[model samples]
Target: MNKVKVLLAEDEASLGMIVKESLESRDFVVFHAENGEKAYEVYQTEKPDILVLDVMMPLKDGFTLAKEIRLENKHIPIIFLTAKSQTSDVLEGFNNGGNDYLKKPFSMEELIVRIKSLLNRIELKPNIENIKIGNYTFNFTKQTLIHSSEIVQLTHREAELLFYLVEKKNEVLDRTFILNKLWGNDDFFNARSMDVFISKLRKKLRNDDTIQIMNVRGFGYKLLC
Candidate 1:
C-alpha cells in the first residue's frame, strides 16, 4: 500500500521536527517546509495527500497559501495550526479553504486524529451518475454543479454535504448528524464550519429559485425542490 503523504509547513524548528518524525513513525511520508513559500514549492513538486500548515509563518501566511492552493486544487484537504482561537480566526481559516484547524499547544494524538479524519473524509469512491436538482445537474464523482453553460466546482466537504442533502431531499437533516458525518465531530468550530459550507451551497444553488436549502429552526436544514 502507498504511504500517506503529508506536507507540514511550520517555522518552528523543534516543533516541525517533532511533527515530521511523529508522522513518519506512523508510516506517513512527510515533507517538511520552514516557511509558506517553501511549503508551496514542496506542494507543487510532491503533490501531497494532505497539508498541515501553521497560520503565522514567514514569507506567506497559512491562509494565503491555502487560498493559492485552492485555486488549483479544491479537493485537497488542508488543516491549519494557529495560536489564535477566536471565532473570527477559525472562520478565516475555513474561508481560505482549510478543512480543519488546531489551536496551539495541542497534543500529537489530536493532530494525528484530525489528519486521519480529514483523510478518511476525502477517500474516493466509485463514480456515480449525475442527478438533477431543479435547473442544476450535480455530478458527485466530478464534484461539480452544472447549470446551462456554467460549471461550479465544489470542494470535498461541499460535495459531501450536497450529496447528503440530495439523499434526504425535503426532510430536515439534523445538524448534529450532518456535523458528525462530515466533520467527524459536532464541536463549535466544526459546527460553524458546517454553517459556512451550507451558506456556500445556498449560493451555488441560487440559480434556480425553486430549489431551496431551508434552515430549520433548532432542527437542521431541508432541501426543498
Candidate 2:
C-alpha cells in the first residue's frame, strides 16, 4: 500500500514541526507549511492524503483553504488544529466539510487515533463506479476496458494495475508499492514489465485527450487529465 502523505499547515514553527514529526513517526509522510498561502501550494503540489491545518495563518485562513481544497478533492480528509474551541467554531469546521478537527494542545496519541479512524472511514467508502476515461469506460466490477464500441480484455495483473492507477489518478504512485503489490518484488525485470503494461494501456487510451499517464522520474507515474 502507498504511504499516506499529510500536509501539516500551521504558522507556529515549533508546533508545526512537532505535529509533523509525530505523524511521521506513525509512518505518514508529512509536508510542513508555515502559512496558509504556502499550505495551499503544498495542497496543490503534494496532494496529501490528509490535511492538518491551523485555523489562523498568514495570507489565507484555514476555513478558506479548506473551502478551496473541498472544490478539488471532496473525499480527501481535512482536520483543523486550532486553539479555538467554541460550539459555533466546531460547527463551522463541519460546515466546510472537515472529516475531523483536533483542538490545539492535543496529545499525540489522540491525533494518531483520529487520523486512523478517519482513514478507516475513507477506506470503507464504496468503490463501485465504472470509471470514464475519454471515449473509454472501465467497468471495474467486470474488470474490462471498453473504448468506442470495442472491448478489450485484461489479464488479472493488467486489471489490478489499471485499478491502482485509476485509484491514484492525478497523484504520484510510488513504483516500489506497485512492484511489491503486483510483482511480489521490485526487481529490474518486473519494473520493465510494468513499463510495458503502462505503454500498452496508453496506446489503448490514445483517443482520450482528457487523460494522460505521465512518468514522474525517480518517484513514479502520475495519471492526470
Candidate 3:
C-alpha cells in the first residue's frame, strides 16, 4: 500500500527535519519545504494527500498558501502550525482555510492523531452516486449535474454543497453546521463563499421547477423537491 503523503513547510530547518523523520517513521511519505514559496511549488508538483504548514515562513505565509490551495481543492485537509497562541491568530488561521490549527510546541503524537482523524472523517463521508434531484441526475464522482441530455460540470465545492443539501433535502440545515463541515470554519469569509456557491447552485437547478433550495432567514438552507 502507498503511504499517505504530506507536504510540510517550515522555515526552521532543525524542526522541519525532525517532523519529516517522525512522519516517515510512521510510514508517511513526506515532502519537506523550507519556505512557503517552495511549499506551494511542491504542492502543485507532488499533489500531496495533506498539507502541514507553519504560519510564519519566508517567501509566502501559511495562510496565503492555504487560501491558494483551497481555491483549487476545497477538500484537501490543511493543518496550520503557528507559534502565536492568541485567539485572533487562531481565527485568522481558520478564516484563511485551515482545517485545524496547532500552536507551536505541539507534540508529534498529537499531530499524528489529528492527521489520522481528518483522513478517517474524509474517508467515511458518504460516497453518493447517481442521485436524482428533481429532473436532474447528480453524479458525485464525476462532479456533474445532468438534465436530459444537457450536462453542467460543477466545481468540487459546488458539488459538495449540492450533495449535502440533497442528502438532507427538505430539512433546514444549520448555517454553522454546514459551514464547519464544508469549509472547515463558519467564519465570515467562508460564509460568504458558501452563499456564493448556494446562489450558483440555485441558478443551475432553476430549470427544474419542482426542486427548490429555500433560504431559511437567519438560519440556513433547505433543498425541497
User: Which candidate ranks first by TM-score, i.e. highest?
Assistant: 1
In order, what lDDT does every prediction score?
0.89, 0.77, 0.85
Question: For candidate 1, what is the total of clashing residue pairs?
Answer: 0
Pairs that collide, model 3: none
TM-score of each: 0.85, 0.56, 0.62
Indicate which candidate wins on lDDT: 1
Tens digit of lDDT per residue, candidate 1, span 42-117?
9999999999999999999999999999889877889999999887787787767787888899898989998888
TM match of model 2 to true structure:
0.56
Model 3 over residues 10-104: C-alpha lDDT tens digits? 99999999999999999999999999999999999999999999999989999999989977876788899999866567656765767677778
Off by over 4 Å in 1: 124-129, 139-144, 150-157
Ranking by TM-score: 1, 3, 2
Residues 1-225, model 2: lDDT tens digits: 899898888999998888888888889999999989999998888878888889989999898899888767666777888788765675466556565577778898878776776677567545445687667788754546888788885533455577788889889989999876554457775577678778877876777788899999998888886
Error of 3 at 59 (Å): 13
* Superposed Cα deviation of residue 109, candidate 1 (Å): 1.3
- Cand. 1 TM to true fold: 0.85
Q: How big is the positional error of residue 81 in model 3, measured in Å on the Cα after superposition?
A: 10
Looking at model 2, report the run of 10 residues with the lowest lDDT sum. Answer: 153-162
Overlapping backbone residue pairs in candidate 3 total 0
Clashes of 2: 0
